[model samples]
Structures are given as C-alpha cells and as structure tokens.
Target: MNHKLLPLKVFLLLALLSLSQMFCGINIQTENPTADPGFMATGIAATLTARAVSITPTVTTEQATQTATQQPTETESQQPVQTEPVIPEAASISVSLDTNCREGPSGDYQKLGYLLPGQTAALIGRNSTSTWWYIENPKKPGQYCWVWGEYATLHGDISAVPLTTPPPPPIPIAG
Candidate 1:
C-alpha cells in the first residue's frame, strides 16, 4: 500500500471501530466545551440525592424514641400552664334600680335596706314560688333578700381544689 493511502486506511478503520462501538450500546459521554463536566455531574448527583432524601422517611425507631424522650423533658421543664377553675355554676345575682332588700325570708318581710343597679349580692336560697332567688345582699350586712331569676344572672366564685379529699376535722375535745 502507498504510504499516503496507508494513513487514510488507518483513519477509516478507527472511525469504523468507533461507529461499531456506538451501535453496540457503548456510551462514551463527551463533555461539551461550553459547560464543565464535573459541575454538571455534581448538580445531577445533588438533585438525585435530594430526591432520594425526600422519597425515603429516614427516621429509625431509636431516633423516634430519642425524640420522644427529649420532648417530654423539655415540656416538663416548661412552666405549669395556668387554667381557670371550673365551677358548677348554679345561680346568679343582679340588682334592680332602687331595689328593696327585705329583713326576713318572706315578703311582708320589712324592707331593711335598698340596693342600686351596680350592687353585688350572693344567692343563698330559692324563693317559695321558685320564680325568684333568695339572695343575701353582700353590701347590706346580715340581710336576706329576694330577686326574680328572670332578671338576675348567676355569680359565684370558683376555686380549684387539688384532686384529693381534705383530711377530716380534728375530733372535738372531751368535756
């Protein structure tokens, strides 16, 4: 073979080999001059890693147990939550303008004192008719009065007791 044609023949053989390798599923990834190959590969790897992290819930039982234990300790160290005392509200008291408070339990009971619209009273009993509440006017000392339930709303102080019974009162001294 001629020397000039020998080089041409070798070049043709190499090209054919490259073409056959491509047809046989040989992947030869060549980096483009415009972009860094490493940067592109790293970005693709990072994206795949992020996708894997999202797809899988990586928490183990030990991790969950550790979190559970740590949380209650933090919660216990937190301040005790203050809650309003729950009261079984039964009755309420209100005032009528220029209202009269009686001296005794029944009407024809003398008016011992009077109350104004802003006065406060404590409900003590129910009236005979059940339509009115028997109230002790807190403002008028030692006075029991009556007011209609239709006009009065309920008022009572609610106190929180610890969830246990108190100890019994001490026995009376012997005579």
Candidate 2:
C-alpha cells in the first residue's frame, strides 16, 4: 500500500467509527470463534471530540514566488502621438454651494430648482447688472430658471450672453 493512501484509509475508518459512536460503541474481546457475540450495548459518552488530521506545515511568514526575468529584445516602435488642447465651453455657471434657482431674477421669485455644488448649468441670459443669470432649470428640462451670481462661478464669456429682463413674480410681493 502507498504511504499517501494510508492516511486516507485511517480517515475513512475514523469517520465510520464516529458515525457508530453517535448511537453506540464497539468492544473488542477474545472468546470462542463460534459463540454468538451478544448485543454490545453502549451510550453517547461525551459532548466534545478530538481527531488527528493531515495538513501542510505552517510557516511563520508568507513565501514569495520566484520568477526568472526575460531580457528585452530590440523592436521598432510607432510614430509620435497627435494631441489637441481642450478648450473650456463658453457661457456656463458652476455653483460653489447649493443655491435656489428661481423663476425669475430675485429672491421674490418662486424657487423652481436648485443649483447644487459641482453642478454646472448653461447660461443663456443675464440680468442688467449681471448679478443674476437666467439659466436652464437644473431640475426641469427645457424650462428656464434664474440663479444668483453671488454663489455661482461664471465660466467662459458672459459678454455674449444676452441681457434678460426679470419676469413678474408668480405671487404678489407683500409690501
């Protein structure tokens, strides 16, 4: 018998014995060969168990795999890569903080949306003083809203952004 198979055979025998040990145990005794071996009564003896198993030896530290490095062979490479400079898109407002985007150019206007931090909105129009930009509503598509310039940073040209007149407030202002 192979030495490697010896452990497997012992493991199988122990497994079968452990199953029988669940119900009863076996006692080996010497007697007449023909005599009837009477009922060998047994009981579940213990709660905890111990068994020997075969496993690879543990090392104190991780072992690194060794590999042979190959020397690079000479080969011809490709042409110089062509690149284009990225230009910032014109007429946009990026809000530094979460600010209310309203129906028109003032605080009196009903808030239609929010210009959140890291959100950029297209600038199509501005107030006469450029203090408010009439922008595409960040929350509603194709609808327009106005955001205060105080919390917004303008990108590209505002010169060509058309001057927008403020619309009448949706609610009557309290005097």
Candidate 3:
C-alpha cells in the first residue's frame, strides 16, 4: 500500500466508527497500531483499528418521569396582561364647512375622503406649524385623514395634540 494513502484510510476508518457509535448508540474503542516510534522505523505503515465496547447510558427512569411531569411555577404560569397605551382624546374638531381630508398635511396631497359641515373628528396629530389637524375620519371607520385647520374649530388643547408624520397616499392600482 502506498504510504501517502495510509493517513486518508485511517481518517475514514475513524470517522465511520464515530458516526456508527453516535447513531447506533454503541460505544467504540480505537487503537493506533503504528503509534510506536519503532513501528515506522521498521517500515510498517500506520494503521487504525477499532472495536465495539459496551457503555450503558446513565439516564434513570425516575429522572425521566420527573422531567416529563415538571410543573410551571406560579411566576411562569401567570403572564402580565398587556394593554394599549391610552392616548387621551386630546381634542375633537368640527368642520365649519364641507372640507377635504387629504392624505398629507397639505392640500396638494390627493383627497382620501371628506369632512362634512357639522361633522366632528377626533384630533390625532397636527403639522409642525400646527396649521393642520390629523383626525380620525368619522366617515371612514378605523381610518384617519387630515383636514385644514382653517376650515375647522378645535375643541381642546391644540398644543396638547401630538404632531404626527402623515401617511403616504395609497398607490392607485391600475386596472
């Protein structure tokens, strides 16, 4: 046998032995036959040898049952209930005239919906300059839009109204 091929053969043998031991749950014993310095001096190639050895796993039946029947502690069993941050209804705005609710702070934005005369909406936010009030649209449930402050009367602290970045307009889907 070529001396160059001896190491590769030894490596493959050791790897196969380890994999078999892991998957079959069998214990293995390995010996390097040419480990002695004099063996190589005598021109003998290095060889790997292995044999099966018995090793019983240490897991006990009582330990296994205890692990399977483990109960959660009181802290683990009870979780803190989560609640949404209450944004106080800071203000409500009533439209003085039929006004357009736009997607953004400016009139240049596309109209999302409308605020009718005498219609009131909850104030959500305002622009940096406080010229716009972002409000929840009464016409569209669960939807918010913006109306010009000039055309509406604010019923609460306009300063307490949080400023918000307006959402982008919905992309028009082309049919």
Candidate 4:
C-alpha cells in the first residue's frame, strides 16, 4: 500500500461529502412544485444578466472600429497651408500720418494740397529722395501734384503710369 494512495482516497471522500452537503441545501424538499418554478426562473434571470454584461463592451468596441474605417480619406489629404496674400502690383497702401503735399522737393516748399482719410490717389512716381510721391488728385480731377509719400495710400486699380502727360519731345539743340 502506497502512502500517496491514502491522501488521494481522503481527498476524494472529502469532495464527495462537500458536494452532497451542497445538494442537501438546494431544492431537496421540493414536494411543492411552486418552489421548483421560482428557483428555475431566478437561475435563468441571473444567467441572462451575466451574459449581457460580458457582451456589451465587445459590441461597443466593434462599432467604434467600423466607424473609424468608414471615414473619408479626402478630409485627411486636403489641409491647406495658411498664408497671407501678396500685395497686388497696383495694391493700396496706407499713410502713416497727417502731412502736407508739397510743391517742391524740400521742406520749405509751398503746400499744394491736403488729403483726408480714405482719400485714394494715383501713384505716379517715387522721388529720387524716395520721401515724396507724385499723385493725381481725383477730387480736383486733371490736377496733378506732389504728395509726401508719408501721407497717402496708393489706390488700387490706378495705373503706375506717370500721373502727368508724357513730356514733350526733346528739343533739337543746334549742333
């Protein structure tokens, strides 16, 4: 007789006794068929509740994955680079402050005109000094004058051509 056989035999007997005790506590006095029906209904409801809880998270994850796969590809590819547009050739620019349009190139010059806010002018030329601009006054049409470059915005849509008529043909200096 092996000693291991003795322990195995004891374990088997203890398992059978525990199972019998469980059965004794479970529905053994079922002379009442009404009691059996209630026990069966409770077992069925508990099984359904356990199954529903186990399946809910799996169902939600699968639905989310399907939606992600179905999204349009074009939306991912169409992102544009954001940038400001370049100023057009005849684009308008603003004056920095209130100032006078002068009659000549220097500061002691006579004031030929004045410009108010939103006054649009034709940009003719930038002086060699670069501080003055020759502009055409639209209010007093056909009048051309020198404006401090600091005082006016070049109007968009006005040509860059010389504001005044082209100069007369060069005089034929005697040889």
Best by lDDT: 2
Q: After superposing candidate 1 on the true structure, give the runs of residues whose Cα lies further than 4 Å from its correct spot.
A: 1-85, 148-151, 155-175
Error of 1 at 120 (Å): 2.3
Error of 4 at 111 (Å): 1.4
* lDDT over C-alpha atoms for residue 74 of model 1: 16
Question: Order the candidates by TM-score, highest first — what do you get?
Answer: 2, 3, 4, 1
Score candidate 1 by TM-score against the native.
0.33
Stretches > 4 Å off in candidate 4:
1-93, 151-175
Which prediction has the highest TM-score against the true structure? 2
**Ranking of predictions according to lDDT:** 2, 3, 4, 1
lDDT of each: 0.52, 0.70, 0.67, 0.53
Q: For residues 1-175, what per-residue lDDT tens digits would candidate 1 score against the true structure?
A: 5674565456556655884775686444544445556666766766777677668665676544322111111111224445555444444455533566654434455565665554556566664445555666655667555554454434543122112221233455689
The better-scoring model by lDDT among 1 and 4 is 4
Give lDDT tens digits, candidate 3, residues 14-71: 6568846665874344443334455443333212111111242346665554322223
81-106 in candidate 4: lDDT tens per residue?
A: 45555444463434534556655544
- Model 4 — TM-score against the truth? 0.34
| Candidate 3, run of 10 with poorest lDDT | 45-54
lDDT by residue (1-175, candidate 2, tens digit) is 6875575466556645875684364443434334222311111111111111113343545776453333333334434454455443478887655899998988888899998866788898999999999888989989999999997777666788999888876777589
Clashing residue pairs found in predicted model 3: none
